[model samples]
Target: MVKEIERKLPVVHVCTIVPISQTVGANRIVPAIAIPHPLGDPTKTEEEEKVIRRRLVEKALRALQTEITEQTVFTD
Candidate 1:
């Protein structure tokens, strides 16, 4: 589980719904695209989708490196 892993290592919860993540005690959260396509957008070209996914991944990476005392949502 995310909370279990987070006890030792930082975990970034990338989900379409932020409220649910918070309810489950996700300290590091990243707002995703959608439920069906959390990391990709079907409306965009393949290359564009890749770029969007890359940015999302980068945000998660940043969240991992950040130090927080309370629940934090990283949005950029």
Candidate 2:
């Protein structure tokens, strides 16, 4: 799905596991919080978790804006 989409539009894959994203040909990858809750942390306060999730979403947006010739993982 990622590769096929990339052919027509820029795409970012936000996942907890980066290797799997790379294996599947995801060009832009954003490291996520966990497998069960990729965008959130249950241990955190609800408000805090929202902030974390927002940051991850912002990271994905940044990844979409970035230009790369090969697979890239945006950890920051």
Q: Pick the candidate with the highest TM-score.
A: 1
* lDDT accuracy of residue 10 in candidate 1: 86
* CA error at residue 3 for candidate 2, angstroms: 1.2
- Look at candidate 2 and tell me the lDDT of residue 66: 93
TM-score of 1: 0.96
lDDT of 2 by residue, 1-76 (tens): 9899999999999999899999999999999989999999999999999999999999999999998998999999
- C-alpha RMSD of each candidate structure in angstroms: 0.6, 0.7
- By summed lDDT, the worst window of 10 consecutive residues in model 2 runs over 11-20
Alpha-carbon runs more than 4 Å astray in model 2: none
Model 1's number of clashes is: 0
Residue-wise C-alpha lDDT for candidate 1, range 21-49, written one tens digit per residue? 99999999999999999999999999999
